[model samples]
Target: MSFFTEIQTERLRLRKLKHTDWEAISYLRSDPDVNKFVKRASADTQEKALAFIEKIRQATETNSSLYWVITKQGQNQMIGSICLWNFSQDRKKAEVGYDLHPLTQGKGIMNEALKAIINFGFNTLNLNRIEAYTQNNNTASINLLKRNNFKLVIGKQDADNLENAVYELKQP
Candidate 1:
């Protein structure tokens, strides 16, 4: 169950996750270097990865979440994932989370994906606010959010209690 077909960026295409993506998904969500800053337990095994995908797919079908596998334009290889989830009751707010393959890091791929999704949230979805939580030590993510004008909300905390800094981008 996919909501939108895909979201395209200059260098990447964000498509709905498929069962075939299990291998890449497992690696991205399980690899030590990749999940170092991620709080969830690793999806190291095929079963765990498949279960995770099912969860995301169900959420998407229910219109409660949207997750996309990130791939390069000319390359079908999945290099990462991004999602808008944890929606508020009124459906006007959501949290954004993303990851990129280590090899693709520092190349601004995630940055581009972020911009496109943020735009979709604001313009297409008509969301009033979009939020993100990143580990305080995850400087790259913090910097990327800042560059996109997502301001840190002092003293505000996520109910999830993951010990992350909360940032918000309000609709313009």
Candidate 2:
């Protein structure tokens, strides 16, 4: 029932998350630099990280989400992660989420990964829209979204997280 698939771009690979990706996931979730503007629970310990991996695995098996680990082409170690989840009840919309190792930031790595995901969402999955919610103060993420042509959703807000501003990219 999973929609898991491997995606290859010019310089990167977006593939299924493996159990061995725990260390990278642990750091990506808990690192101060990476989570500075993030507002979710962190996997600060190994056990918590593993649990998260299992959660993601089960979610994928249920077709609840599509998650990918980002790495340079031919590499197995994950330097970042991205996902399309939180599908709207009608299945026309889904939220996009991502994070990268600080060392990998500013390299346009995420920009490429997101482009691929957007294509998958719109063309492959037949989605009508892809949404992103970032802290209004998270300039890097906001800029990334805008660069991908995601427009700020006027007057719409995340009720549970007032600090978040929603952005959306509709099918072309």
Q: For model 1, how does the per-residue alpha-carbon lDDT over 1-172 read when each residue is reduced to its tens digit?
A: 4455598888899998998899998999888888877778678999999999999889999989989899999888899999999989998999999999899999999999999999999988889999999988899999999999999999998666557899999998
Candidate 1 has its poorest 10 consecutive residues by lDDT at: 1-10
- Which candidate wins on TM-score? 2
Q: For model 2, how does the per-residue alpha-carbon lDDT over 81-137 read when each residue is reduced to its tens digit?
A: 999999998889999999999888999999999999999999888899999999999
TM-scores for every candidate against the unseen true structure: 0.95, 0.98
Off by over 4 Å in 2: none
TM-score of 2: 0.98
Model 2's alpha-carbon lDDT is 0.93
Model 1, global lDDT: 0.91
